[model samples]
Structure formats: C-alpha cells, structure tokens
Target: MLRSIASTTALALILSGHALAEETTHDDHESVTLYRVFVGDHADPKITAFDLDKPDNRWTFETKGQSKLYGVGEGAAVVAVQSDGDQVNFIDSGISLQSHGDHSDIDIEEPEALGETLTGPRPFHLIDHAGKVVINFDRGGYAEIVDAHDLSEGEVETVRMPQARAHHGYVAPIGTGWVTSVASDAPVEGDKAPERVGLQPVAADGTPTGEVETCTAIHGEAFSGAYLATGCKEGILTVKAGSNGPEFAMLEYPSDLPAGETTGTLIGSKSMQVFLGNYGAKGLVVVDPVDEPHFRYVELPFRRIDFALDPANARFGYVLTEDGTLHKLDVLKTEVTDSAKVTEPYSMDGDWNDPRPRLAMAGDEIAMSDPKAGLVRRIAKETLEETGTIEVGGMPYNIAVVGGSGMVHEGEGHDHSGHDHSAHAHSHGDPQIYKGYFEDSQIKDRPLADYAGDWQSVYPYLQDGTLDPVWEHKAEAGEMTAEEYKDYYTTGYRTDVERITIEGDTVTFYRDGKPLTAQYSYDGYEILTYEKGNRGVRFIFEKGEGDAEAPQFLQFADHGIFPAKASHYHLYWGDDRAKLLEELTNWPTYYPSSLKPDEIVSEMLAH
Candidate 1:
C-alpha cells in the first residue's frame, strides 16, 4: 500500500559501453519496473520475487526473524519492517537496478538492511509519503520518519487520541507537516471501540498546529490532488490545503443508509477528489468530498477480501470479494463494470490475523494474492481478462513489486548530461486531468470521436504568465467558486476553434491547406502525430470525469518540439457535442509579445 519511489524522474544513469571507442550520444528513457511481484510468506521468514516478463522464473530471499513485509513497491526501494521488540529494523526490500540508456538487464543481489530506527514493541503501518517512509510504532505511540533515499534515522513523534486509546495510529505527510490521529490520554476501554477520536495537523518538527478535528471511531484514510479523505463514524472528513496548514471539514454519513454505518477502509482516486470506501459489510461507497448528497453505493454479495485502486490507470480499479471474485470498478461511473472469480471463496468469518486474499496494482495489472493457495493471480488491464498466475512456495500473505526501467550507455565517452531536449515542460509535468491525456488502442477503438465542422476557438494568453498559479489550488478544501474554478481550468482550452470536419474515423485537421492525419504510436497515450513544417506534433488525450458515464469533456494537449518561450496552442471539442461549436468562450484581454500564443492553426488544429 505504501510505495516509496525515489526521485527517478530527476535521476539518470549512463548505459552505453561503445562510448570509449568513438564519439557517442545518449537519449532519455522513462522509468519502468523490471520485476512483477514480491510475495511475503507468512508461513516462513522469506519473500519470493517474480519476474513480470517471465512469471515462471522466481527468486526467494530470507528475511531472518521478520515475519511480515509492510511496504513493497516498485519505487526506488522496497521497505520491510521488522518487529523484534527493542531491536526492530527497517531493511532493504531487495536489490533493483536503474539505468539512463534505453534498456538494461535486471541485476540480482543479496538482500540487506537499508537502515534502522527505534526498535519498538511493534511497528505496524509503513506509509510512503512524497519520498520518505513513515513507520508507525503502535505500541510505542509514536511515528518515525526516515529519508527514503538514504534511510537515515529520523525523529520519532508522539501521538495521542484525546478520548480513547489509539489502538493503531496513522500519519500522512503533506507539505511540511503531518495529518495525524492523536494518541488517547487514557487506556482503551474494555471490549469497546473509541467513542470519539481526534485528528490534528502535526508539523514536521513534532508540534501540533491548528485546531484538533474530531470524528467518531475514526478509521480509513486516503488522499488525492489537494484533498485528503478520512473515514469516521459519521461519514468522511475532508482536509483541504491551506497556507497556514490543512483544515478539516466533516461530511455526515448518508441519511438513507440507516444506522450502524461506518467506513473501515478507504482508497482515493489517483487524480480526482473521490474516494472508494467500505461501508461496514453492506457494500462499497464512493464518496465525493465536495458533492456528498449523491453517494454511489455498490452492494457486495459476500464479505470483502481486499480492494485497491490502479495508480496508473484512472478509469478502473478493482475489488476482491471474499467469494474470490474480482470486480472491476469503473471509478468515474462508480459501479461494477466487470467481474471474474480469481480464487475459491475465502470466508471472512475468522480471526483478523488469518490469511486471506489481498489485492494490489502492479503497473497496469490487478494482482490478487491467494494466501491459502500460495498463488498470485494477475488480471490484465483494459480487457479485464485473466493474464495467468504465479505460484509462491508458501503462504503469500503480502506482495509488492520492485524494479523500474532504466538505460546504460555502451561506451564511457558519452556525457549523460549532454542529452538536452526541448523542455515540453507542460507535458513533462506530472499527469493531471488538464495537463495530460493518453489513449491506448487497448483501452478503446482506433478513434474515440469523429468531427467535420467549423469549430470556433477562443484563445486566452496569460502573456508571460505561468499557468501554475491559475491551475494550482491553495484553498483549504480544494473547493472554489464557479468563477474562481473557471479562471484556472479554462486557461488550458482555446475559445476560438476554427474550421474542422470530422466524419467518422477520418479526421483531417487542416494546417496551411494540408491535412495532418492521425496515426497511433508511443504507449497508446499519444493519440496521433503529424508534421508541421520541420517540427512534429503529437496529440494526447485526458478526461477528468469523476462519474462512470464517461468523461463529459475530452482534454487533448499538443506536445511538440517547440521552445518554451515560443507561443503554443491547445484546445478541445466545444462542450456541446451535437453541433460541436457552442461551448463556453472567455477571452483574455492581455497578450504580451514575449509569451507567444499556442499555434492551434491554419484551418484549425488538434487539442
């Protein structure tokens, strides 16, 4: 659940070996995981590593006295927490290699400890925040933060629940502080849950700031964009970003749901501000922080085994039922879109520590761990088909993947730092609903839409103005007025979309009397590529729909080899799909000569 990825986006390693023999050059290669899964054996002190490319081939490593693996991720490093009382250790997940070239073979090495911190009675939740790892010592009533890069020892901060004893505490880092549950001042009551719990903003320096926010029998928590959702007895607590710190707003439990309703587990969207939460055992609930009245609920036939969201694919996530069926959750639509039985029913009427089915997302695949069967079943993306399974030698209670794509130069002569490409900073920035869009042939048909008409375009230029401030949300709850929201979000589209005829799959975006046809390539995200004089242009698609009916608006960004200071253009099909022209158009009065406008173009252009 916790993945501590190193800053790989900023780090590059050389790969070619031919450089010493002659002059050489290198190109950029994006990060990728080499290994598929690391199954944590509960029956023994070992973890089995599975190759994504070759599932039959596997490797097992001994973890000594540790009986569990908490945070196994494909990030730069994997973390294993050891609870050996006062000698607890947070050790290395395993050895993984990264390169700067196009491709590099996976390296195998012995496992060792990354570092150590307070060896407490028990270290439970291991969360990866930003780039650091937070280890929660439940027994010690403290949370320790360690630098993910070096695993250096960090300060341990105390936490206390105001009314009831904190059986298990949580800590999530935001900006320079943490959203933490307080440790109770008194011991927990017998065979009884906490009547009320309190949460507060805790600074990185261990001091509590802002007013303490309270919830009843608080449990599940999740984060997305500028919003953080925490589940409690009443409903969900939404913490919004703020200049002073984060502020909490309570959303009461749904009125029609009746009594005895509470959320035990929560998973937030990777981009949108919506959360998938467990409503006791009745069913699953999709809670929107801003819009709470229309909560989407999907009932379960049996109890839940485990559920997880696909970090890379925003459209669908999955839920594994105790009946062994994996249901595909159309997140935007908030419903069960597809389902398949992955394993035999694993009843939930047993001890909490009993081995059961668990779910996780390994890249684009949905992996289900069948602890009783000692197997990990993977579901392919898009198709919702069985991709096959991998066998671990023991009870695979937990699984995590470690390894990413990298490159190595042939010769030592090439300077890795010398490969300077156009910034394309807008596209390079992290994927956002407006900032990026990708369409894979596997996800949908060749073309998503067809248009042939004169589309009007209204262009807005900040003129030497950075879109950052307009796009960034600094409010406490990620909530803004209609006017405020439109200002920042509308800046990405053009109001003046001109002549364009789209009839079926044939889309001829005319440029200077010539047509730029759509041809697919590159990770399926780049929908089409066309030539503009000496430079080439690529169209990428993205949607920001939080509903399952599909994205109401399609976002396409034009990524070209253009200089940063040069003018550029990006737009979308007008909001009205019928005529494809009547959409909201707002004009920017100021256009500075230095900023240059986006080239949407001659007969009109692609998003």
Candidate 2:
C-alpha cells in the first residue's frame, strides 16, 4: 500500500472554498467527499466507518473477534482478529479511495464483511505485506500466510519461531522473505534480553534461510520507509532489501545515554526513515537511525498513553499522555512544538485494560477516542483545538482513517474498447472537469513547487526487476507456464535513482534510497562529478525541451546501464518529455506566497 496521506486540510477549504478547483471544459468530473474514519467498538464487537467531517453518515458491521487484533491497508481494506477460531475476519472497509497525479479522494460506502481467513491460535500481529496477509499467533509461535483478496480459501501455511516464550514477538514479510524477531537460538526469556534476539529470515517457501542477523534484546518492530526495524536495548536494527537480499544494519545509541535505555515502543514515519519511540516513562527519542548524527530525544511531561506519527504532516509526531494533552512532536527540530488538551486528566495508573484515551486522525483532524467518556474527540489540526465529538455506545478500540474524495461518474456510456481517442475532438459535449483541490493541501511549510537539494531523475526506466502485471499474473493463476510467461514479457527492474535530495556533500537517494556522503565538483556547464571514496560518476543537468533553457532532465553518463541501440538516456521531468506529458500532467503553473489555485492560474495566464 502506498502511504496515501491526507493532503487537503480544513483551513484551505474554509479559506479558498471550492475555487481551488477551477471548472474546466476538459473531461468528466465527479463531486465527492471521502474522509471516512473506522472505529472498532470492543464492547459492541463492531467496526464502524463514518464520515470524519460529518459523523451523521456512518455504517457499522458486526465483527467476530474481540481482542482488537487488526490491520488496515492503504487500499482501505480491514482484517480484524477472529481470536475465537482459527480465522481472521476480512471486512471491505467501505472507503472508496482513489489517488492519481496529485489528487486524492476519501469516498465512503457501506462497510461490509467480505469473509474471514483461517489463522492460527491467538492471532497476535497482522501485517499486509504487498497484499499478502501475515498473521502471527502468540502461544503457537507460528506465522500464518493467507491470501488477502480471498481469505476463505488457501491452505494456511505457517512457520514457527522457536523462541522460549509464549510468543511475544513480531514478524514482517519483506518481499518474499519473512523477517521475525526470535530468541537467539538459545533458551532465553522474552523479557530478559530486550536485545538478545536475532532477526531471522524465512524464505518464501516457509524455510528458514539459517541467516540470523543478531540484535540484542529486540522487542518492538515497525516499518519506516523501506526498512523494517527491530527495536533493541542497545540501538535499532534497520532491515532493508539490499543488493544481495535483506540487509540488516545496526544503529547503536550514543554511549553517554542512560544505562538502562531500551526501545520497547516505536512508531515509524511513512514518508521518511524516522522513528518516534519511548525511551522511558517520561522520555521520547527521535531517531533517523542510518543518517549522520542520528539520534535526538525530548523529555515528556508524563508517561505516554499512546503515540502515532503524522505521515500527512511528516514533520510532526502526535503523542497522548495520561494527563489528557496531545503533544505534537517536530522530527527535524527534535522538540515538542504544539500541545492541546484533548480530555480531562486520565492518568495511566490503573490496569492496562482500564478505559484510556486513544489518539487517531480524521483527515486533517486529530481524533482522540475517549472510551471512558463514550465519545470520540475531534481536534482541529490547524488550530489544535477540540472541534466536536461523536457519541458511540461502546468503547472504540481500533481506529483508522481511510478512503478519500474521488470521482463517481454519473453519466454512462457502454463503449468499452481501449482505443486511441486522440484523433477525435474531445470538446463536443465533453464531460466538464469539476474543480477539485490538489491532494498536497496539507503540506504548508514549503511551497509545493519550491523543492531544494540535488535531485536525481533516471532515464530508460529500470530494465531489471520483478512484479510483471499481465504475464506474471497468468503464471500465478496457473493459466500459463512460468517459462512461457517469462518469454513473452520479461521481468523489468528500476535502478536506485528514483528520486534523491543532495545538499552540500550529503545525498539521500529516496527510491531504493540510501544515504551517501560524496564530494561533488563542477566539471563544466551543468555537468558535475560525484566521487565517494575513489568511485565516481558524472552527472549532467541538460536543458529540457520546454523554453530551451529550462532544466528538466538529469542524465548519468557512467554507472548506469544504457538502453540497447539508444543514443543517450536521460531522466525527463516525468515518465516522458514528449508534448503529450505537458497535456496529460497537471503541473504547478505558478509559484507564489499564497497557494490559492485560482491566483496561481491567473498569474500563469498573465505571464
């Protein structure tokens, strides 16, 4: 699931109105509002999907499991734990979400239960790794694999983690290999060696590769960026798909920190490789584990009740306390920037099951589910104040914001042929392009168009890789042989140069992104040389076809494979630099202090 973050905030809507989307005579447009919030009522045994903006519109579906064990994918699909039996309930989380170019919608539908998956005993952890479901059982110490689309069928394959405990561990499927935190092959207790666990690799066929990357006292696990990290007493282990296979690198803590620090709890960011975690009862740590000068911490006012990273607002982390105040954390600055009292002081002194305040997001609003009050608190993300509340009968446990505003075509046409319509005039009774706001309405600190740093765009598209759409799917369905499918459409791969930011001597390659410390010097014109310990590559920023002098392409003369029989390979601004891209792509037409769409368009027209 692509981390689809909330883009359009409430402030922008109130200030600009629908003028942000200019009605154009382009094509068919649909008017839709899709912010749907799902709350799992533990006492009631139901999952409810309701409009975050308007709570009156909602749908609740009965659930089978009560432990609140669940997972929510980016596609707005929900899988709840069915602890009573060897099955996990699959619910069609009625959020019809769609994102294209720079626009997204939060469309909602009546939530329905699709089916259930045959899982193992005590399904503890759930993770949707590239559409496949991984369910971990606590007492059985086995990880079950089931088809995410059709949970009713499939012989549930399970692999056991032979740790000397009742399975308080975690598992993640990175590509075809499953990564799990297991006890270090010895008779070790789960709570003792907080870092004395090995991140063992389980192959796609449920066979352990026997490669155990060691991490002492590994407790909690999470996915931030492309790496699946396992928290330890000493530091954190960043596990990512490497050139060979899943690579594990240890990011150790500074020597000067407290003697008994352990990473027991962690919440990672989807936009970047960062984590916000509990250092102790009254302390929190912000870690960019692999980057230089990697660690930072902030002292909390009270013990953390719960914390979640605001991926939509990438710079901040949301933390709730027993004191009933929600604190906003700044990742880059490593400080608590904003605070708002969500509920009356609900101390974390009682039993863990005692009704406590929960923190979540309803689009751009911060939602705190107060089970004790039997109300879901909504706080304005812009003003950080309590906006309103929605009353529910039971204690809301599992919560997620999914679906988005998208187009639902009203008019109908039966023609279904996939043909080139470029020759025909699209102006005759063309579907009116409804005015809509861009999905980037939430990013306010920086201009949408104004991005600084050494950016790398690659060309010829990556030619070596996995995941083919047509032929592979046929092979998977047993409709064609594997050899036959490979002969038709060969597997394609993309290089590490998807997107990058280089400033000074440091560069973070954001695709198969890796941080590199290099020395860059100008060779000639826009041509430059990047040398990292003797290995060097030539980089040139050639002018794009637009306006002749406009820089829109980046090319690497060395270190990249060139297309066969091609003259040169260049990374154009987008997929292609052809005139067609200019028409299909809705780019930033103007850059100004105020991000009003109408004003920006007017300025561009005037120019």
Give all TM-scores, in the order shown. Answer: 0.58, 0.62
Error of 1 at 159 (Å): 14
TM-score of 1: 0.58
lDDT of 2 by residue, 1-607 (tens): 1111112222211111112122233344454544556677757667776667667676777765554534354545666775655456666665534232233323344566664345566776676544356767766766666544333222233344443344556677663346776754455565442324667776655467657777776777766655677777668778765423466888888765555877777777766678887887777888786777766878888988888777577788788887888888888898988998878887778876566766776557787778777788888776688888888668876676665444443343211132111111111121221122222322122111112223323111112222233334445544457555444222111233444443222222333543322222222212112121111122333231222222233323211221111111122132222331222111111121111233222221211
lDDT of 1 by residue, 262-372 (tens): 886888775455788888775888888786463677787777777877776766778888887888888778788878877888888978757887776766676777887
lDDT minimum window of 10 residues, candidate 1: 13-22
Which sections of candidate 2 miss by over 4 Å? Answer: 1-26, 65-71, 82-87, 105-107, 147-166, 184-196, 410-607
Error of 2 at 326 (Å): 0.9
Which candidate leads in lDDT?
2
**For every candidate, C-alpha RMSD to the true structure in Å:** 17.0, 15.0
Q: In candidate 2, how many clashes are counted?
A: 26
Name the best candidate (by TM-score).
2
lDDT of 1 at 437: 29
TM-score of 2: 0.62
> Candidate 2: how large is its RMSD?
15.0
